[model samples]
Target: MEGGGGGGQELSTDNVKGIVLALLSSGFIGASFIIKKKGLRRAAVASGIRAGVGGYSYLLEPLWWVGMITMIVGEVANFVAYAFAPAVLVTPLGALSIIVSAGTFYPE
Candidate 1:
């Protein structure tokens, strides 16, 4: 398929790889947020202080740490994906992932 505005240049394999990476990154990042939120809730219950109210107790929660690590991995994937594809193609896929994650986690 000839890419628009690229003088009939075909999409490279790297571009496909980038799109896949972007999708993976989005999924992980979304899961991380949900995990972190769950951890924060647990921390709040354990410590009697809500994280939203400036409680740092979630910092001690293992689940929260796991979520942070997940987010980091997602970010790294996103960065690498960016290297393989144009931002125009990558960004939207990432956004879609976020939407999917949100809908999966919060069903209200």
Candidate 2:
């Protein structure tokens, strides 16, 4: 059976870039999870802010603001990193953040 194309097989750089962006986004999401968790912990201890654990806005609690900002910045960096590097490589490197977060955040 003939495929649908001049021949039917040509790699698109855009597809690769999209995949890279997706992976990069994933790493940022993981990092965001850690950061937001830590931030919520902070906010809870802060003395003047309230926190709840239901719904979408729960992730944006005042204690979690620092985390939100950090995650935003990290995501921007991840995109830039992915634009220049392969997802396979970038994702592994981003995994390091998990260790870092566990050590720093989980302890508190």
What's the lDDT for candidate 1? 0.88
Candidate 2, residues 1-108, lDDT tens digits: the string is 557757665546754665565565555556677768867666555544546643344454664666677678767767776666566656666665565555554565
Q: TM per model?
A: 0.83, 0.48
**Candidate 2 whole-model C-alpha lDDT, 0 to 1:** 0.62
Model 1 segments more than 4 A misplaced: 1-10, 106-108
- Candidate 1, residue 105: CA error in Å? 3.7
What's the true lDDT of residue 76 in model 2? Answer: 78
Best by lDDT: 1
| lDDT, model 1, position 11 | 71
User: What TM value does model 1 have?
Assistant: 0.83
Candidate 2, residue 5: lDDT? 53
